[model samples]
Target: MGQQVLYETPQISIRYDDYAEWLHVEWIGDQDYESVVSGATKMLEYLEQQGCRKVLNDNTLVTSMWADAAEWGGKEWFPAMRAAGCEYFAWVYSSNVYSRLSTDLTIQYTAAGIVILTFDDINIARLWLQQM
Candidate 1:
């Protein structure tokens, strides 16, 4: 199957790569907490619809910290995604230290069933997901 671009704006792009068996999201510029929740929910919906259990979330392009979004993802999104059949979340760690820190904080609150891994290289992330 061809890739489906679920949502795209200046700040983010969400898609499903069938061959990879994962949802892909590349964040661009700075993102606010509100947009992250909405966009991420849509991505998760597409992920479940496509029967993909993994996500290659590339935050390397992001330039700002989103602590609120991080908290929300941990408290709400991650669990919902897990219930929807997502098992592995491969995050492409942001080059920005603060963004990675925010993600770490989010991970601390994530449900234990969700397998979250951080990677600086997207290819490594993809390989990791492929094995999942």
Candidate 2:
């Protein structure tokens, strides 16, 4: 649980962990798209500081609506993350629609490699990371 804060706001906390090449984000409630993108950027900076060339976005604690503004936030942040040298990305999500959309977007952008996993198992996600 070695967590380093990358950014913090009233609604979210973005952190990085050493044990895993991942950026763990916890969103509390509705937040503007700019805040989300800024938080994500801070996470990316932390990843760079940790020498992580890739990241696993563990969104298990995320409870915000992934519609409208959040969707726009993701679109803005994801491309910037790829350009910032994030070579691989993966998310462990509970929603089928979110997982499918995220995975599909990852493939479509052709930026970093991306994978989405259901909540039942994370071993596959870890395996995908190992191959990165």
Candidate 3:
């Protein structure tokens, strides 16, 4: 396996594994909407440069939300991802009812080929990505 780059910010940690064809992100600390959007945008740019087509976002650690900001961020990134050739986007999350519902709704409405998965197991995430 090739080395993965881990980008650490105050609100999140992003790991990109080239050999595994996955970009794994875990939100950390307090998540402000603007910060999340900025970080995600940077991560997407990096992934595009690295030719990543799939992503696994583990938001289990995300402790806060800026709903409006999150919605805007999603709007900005979803189309950018399609342009960058992203094929799959999955979420590995605990059973947080509101978060799960919100993420599900977003995925359901997105025109991009982003798939959101709520799973308790890491292996399940890997399997989903492999099948993509």
Candidate 4:
């Protein structure tokens, strides 16, 4: 499936795949708590607008872990996204060990009933979500 850019920022780019009914989020550079929240919120908004239930979040390029944002993503964003029809989430693991630590923490709280998968390879992530 192909995608079109729905929103773009210096730190992140949000794209939508109509055929797959998924949102493709590419994170670039380091992000702080605010930017993390804002970018994710923007993606969720676009996901909802597209009436999609899946997301492919490529965080491989993120240089640092906004650890503080993990709690917010868990406590806030995950539920909202799930409510907005997000049933599947596929995350491309960060190469940085520290970033992986933060991602692990976030994974713990992505909420129950939602499918969450993490992959080292982007193509694997895409293929897994594409099955949905």
Instruction: State which candidate has the highest TM-score.
Output: 4
Ranking by TM-score: 4, 1, 3, 2
- Looking at candidate 3, the ten consecutive residues that score lowest on lDDT are 64-73
TM-score of every candidate? 0.93, 0.60, 0.81, 0.94
* Collision count for each candidate, in order: 0, 0, 0, 0
Per-residue alpha-carbon lDDT of candidate 2 for residues 4-121, written as tens digits (9 for 90 to 100):
7777777667677666766665554443456556666677677666666656655454444444444443456566666666666665663445533543454454433333333334
Stretches of candidate 4 exceeding 4 Å from the true structure: none
lDDT of each: 0.86, 0.57, 0.70, 0.87
Superposing all C-alpha atoms, what RMSD in Å does each candidate have to the true structure? 1.4, 4.1, 2.3, 1.1
Between which residue pairs do clashes occur in model 2? none
* Candidate 4 TM-score versus the reference: 0.94
The residue-by-residue lDDT of candidate 3 on 1-132, one tens digit each, is 664666787777778876777788777655556776777787788778778888888767655443545465566677788788777877775355555555555555566656556676767887888898
Candidate 2 lowest-lDDT run of ten: 111-120
TM-score of 3: 0.81
Clashing pairs in 1: none
lDDT for each residue of candidate 4 in 16-128, tens digit (9 for 90 to 100) = 98778789999998878999889988988998799988999999998897888888888788988888988999999889877777788887766746788889999999889
Question: What are the runs in model 1 whose C-alpha is more than 4 Å off?
Answer: none
Tell me the tens digit of each residue's lDDT in model 1 across 1-132: 567888888888888887887888998878778878878888777877888888889999989988888878898889889888888999998899888888898998887488899999998998899998
**TM-score for model 1?**
0.93
